[model samples]
Structures are given as structure tokens and as C-alpha cells.
Target chain A: MREDHHDQPHAPDHPMTEFEWRVDAVQALLIEKGVITADEVRRAVEEMDARTPAQGARVVARAWVDPAFKARLLADAKATIAEIGITVGFDATIVAVENTEKVHHAVVCTLCSCYPRGLLGYPPDWYKSLNYRSRAVVEPRSVLSEFGLELRSDVEVRVLDSTADMRYLVIPVRPAGTEGMSEEELADLVTRDSMIGVAQARTPALR
Target chain B: MTRVHDRGGWPGSGPIDKSEHDLSWWEKRTDAIASLLMSPEKRVMRVDELRRAIEDMEPARYEQSRYYAKWLHAIETIMAEKGVLTREEIDRKVRELSARR
Candidate 1:
């Protein structure tokens, strides 16, 4: 159901940026020569769109309720996540680190904006911004405080740097007094920020 | 070259713009093309390689362009380097596409 831009002429009055023109030309040529089809491009768009925080919440939810799944998530995240039928575009490894009362894990890609895009959708604007890349690892506690998440002074913060080959996912601690909650109920506490380790999972009252 | 696109610990930061805005059609297309270039299923190129290509951009252009613009630069550069699409052909196609509009 995508619009066909093949025949549309740009109104001379409205100029496109250089990159926009380049993409148009490159895509058109690629499609014409059969290197890649518009369908493939459309599928890529849909696949990226399909990746959302809900998927991450689902994974976090299961991990919270099932110790076995949580163990597998920490030991071999890609394999276990795939077992649950989730596929991210990149072929790199994703490692899940859990937070405990004694320690917290915060993820950052200092090199570039490496992220678990398959699970969290596009990294938020803040995630990719120069501000986040610079501050996340250098002063994570302060960063979290800005996100309204002030970790206890004694909580050890482990900043995980993601390389091109490996991404990191932070599994936040399960909130207290929720033993009777179902996986779906537990999943509701999981937010993108919590999974990224900037914030804690939502409490029952917040929902 | 070392800094490349690495913004880690570079400088002070202003407030983050938290408002979410929808991407334009071209930006979405650029995203698709960029991701498809590194699709695990299709395997056209490594994301590191694309990063390298992007890093090779003129320093000013690298810093001045928007993220999607950088993606376009990387994609076009890598495609040309891989012989998937020649630079001239892309230029010609751009002219054709623009003329259509």
C-alpha cells in the first residue's frame, strides 16, 4: 500500500535535499536493474516498524516471571530471543545483563548509536543524540537522575559499551510485592527506559 | 578519522528534544535502504563497513548533515564501491528522477 513515487515529478518550487534526491535516484536505479525491489524496501520498512517497545516488554516480562528464561536471556540472548520468534535486522550478538540490588547495568554505544533495534524499535532521539552518547557512560548515575531515576548511592553502576558486533540489553530488577502478578501484568511494568537501564521498572501504583 | 562518527564524551549537551515527529517519506525510504544494506537475511554489507564509508565523508559534511543524510551518503558510497551501482549511473538517475518531478 506504499505510494508509488516512480512517476511523480517534484514541484520545481519545492526542492528536495541532496540526500533525498540521491536516495530517490539510487532506489529507482536499483529497482529498475533488479538489484532490489520496491517490495524489498517496503518489507524493510514494515520489519523495522514491527519492532517496538512492546516486544522488549514481552521479553522483559517473561524474564521477570521465569527464572529459567531469565537465565537463558543472560547466557545466550540472541538464541533465546529467536526461540521466542523475534528477529532483529543486524546479525550482531545481543547480551542481556541483569540488575540486582547491589548493582545496576547501563547500556551505551560510545562508538556509534548501536542498539537492540529489533527489540526497542529505533533508538530514541535522545539515545542517538550527542548528549546521551557523551554522558551515558561517563556519569550514568547523573544521567539516570536526569531521567528521574536516582539509583541508591550504594548501587554499583556497570556501564556496558556496545560494539558493532554486540549489543547490550539491561534487565531491570522485578519490582517488589508483585509475586502474584501474571506475566502480562509483570510485562506492563517494563518500559523502554527500564530496559535500557536509565530508569527502573514501573511500580504497580504507576500503572 | 579516529573520532569518525563517535560522539562519545565530545562536549557539553543541551536539553534533549523529547517530542516525537514522524519521518518524511524520503527519510523512511533512506532508513529502509540503509537497513536493507545490512539485512541479516540478505547480507549486502556489514554495518561497520557502512560506518567506515560514512566516516570517510568530508569532516564538515559528516558533522553538518542530518542522520538520514549520513545514511544516504554511506549507502551511495558503499553501493558504488561494491559495484552494485555506479556513481555515474546514480547521478544520471538522479537527474532523470528530478526531471520527472
Candidate 2:
């Protein structure tokens, strides 16, 4: 007999996958190429999730402290956001709706999820749901009611529709008694719903 | 090691095991380009149009493949490279690409 193992077959080493193997491979290659470190990639993803500017908290905080800036934001959301170095006009048309105690504003992308992520970071879970889409336009009051926000009947509900081009974000009026509060403290009170015009911004109770 | 005699069974007579096809660099690049098409604001292409565009861009090897299958793969590949596309830049790029010959 020939002293060879050529007649034997070996199992294949790799199995083909139908998933996004290429993306993972590219990230690995980027790490290897030193273009971006593994830590950098992780941090970037975390930053994206942690505080997307779409909330417009920065704008709200500035508005709380500066009346002139607040006037600018109310006049033009796109220009105001740009002033803060957050690009807002390229993708979705951002409109700034002011919410006061007497009259509240609520925004909805009836056609799609047109949100200002550049200012707010990320859209909340409910913003992307069908209930929000269907109810926001037809019954804004009912939807807001569910979120524990009941508007007085006298208050006009100005619901802004965000289509492909015109995206809107609500600029909530600064809560009372929050005077002398730091920008960070004001930002903390600016919830995602407050920016969407669904609910009023809440402040800490006095001790 | 012990030597063995031929048993009637032949070696390598079974079907050739298919090689795992890793996406090439060009394929990945094409995917990155395609990701620009998906944005929240842009008027997205219809299924047929998307299929046509992908087919036109694909290499000659994949030309005869099923249109829907390949296009689905392209979209899936795009979603994987999530950071590759932004709503604004992609919309502009898509418009520019669409205007091209």
C-alpha cells in the first residue's frame, strides 16, 4: 500500500454565513489598520445611544438662560441648531414649536419617523410606534392624555406634521421656579417627550 | 502510522464542498454606496427601481442571479453598515447618482 494519507478527506474549516459578516470584518480591519481603535468604535456607538442631540436639550437650556437665543430658536429651529454646531437641515426639515402652560404643542411624523436626532440624539421607543402615528394626528389629545399630559380644553393644540422634508421639534418653555439653575440642571428637566411637545418639562420639587 | 489497502470506497468521490464566499472589497464598497440610499427623509426607491439600480451596479458574475434575492442582500448589507449613511448626505448622493448617466 502506498504510505500516503492523500486518500483521506478533511472537514472544511469555515462555514458560510448569510449575515453581516462583512461589516464585522471591516470593523476588525479598521482596528487592525489603526484607523480607529476597538475602544473608539465602542465609544462611538455608546455616544450615539447616550445623548443624541435630536432632543434639543442644549437649545432648551440656552433658551432658559437667554431670551434673545430663545427668540431665535422659536423663529427658526434650523438656524438655531446650526448655531450650536448641530446640523439639522440636511435630512429632515426641523420646525421649533414652543410649548407654554396655557397652550401646548405636540409634534408627530405622521408619514414617517422624521425626528431631529442631531439635537435630541435618538427617538424614544414610543415615537416610532404605529399608535403614535395613527393617534397623533387624529386624536392628539387622547395620546397626550395617555402620557399623563392633559391639556385644558381652552388651550389650542397645535399639532405639527413632519413629512419627508419638514421635520419639527418642540421647544418647551422653561419650567417656572427653575431660575438660577445650571444649564445641566435645566437640561435634565428637558425630557424627550417635552421636546416632542407631548408633555411639559418637569422641574425638581422644592425641598 | 499503519498502511491500509484500498477498500472499494474511493476518496473524493462525493460532491465538492462549496467554498464559503466572503464578500470581496468591491462588494463591501458597493454596499457602503448603497447604504446612502436609505434615509428617513429621502423618497426611497421602489422595489423594482432598487433592484434595477443594484443589478446595474453589480459585477457581471451576479448579473444572471435573481433580482429580488440580490437586492435583498444588498439592503441587508446596507443596514449592517449603519454608520455608513446619514439622511442628508445620502439623499444628496442618491440624487447625484440618479442624475448620472
User: Would you list the clashing residue pairs of candidate 1?
Assistant: A9-B100, A9-B101, A10-B101, A134-B9
Candidate topping TM-score = 1
lDDT of 2 by residue, A50-157 (tens): 446434787788888888888888787788867877664234556677777677888876543557764565566466444565567767787788777888898889
Model 1's DockQ score: 0.63
Q: Return the TM-score for candidate 2, rounded to 2 decimals.
A: 0.55
Q: Encode model 1's per-residue lDDT on B1-101: one tens digit a residue.
A: 35756766666655555556566677778888777767776667778888888778887887677777888888888888888998899889878766766
**CAPRI quality band, candidate 1:** medium
Native interface contacts kept by each candidate, as a fraction = 0.71, 0.01
Give the clash total for candidate 2.
16
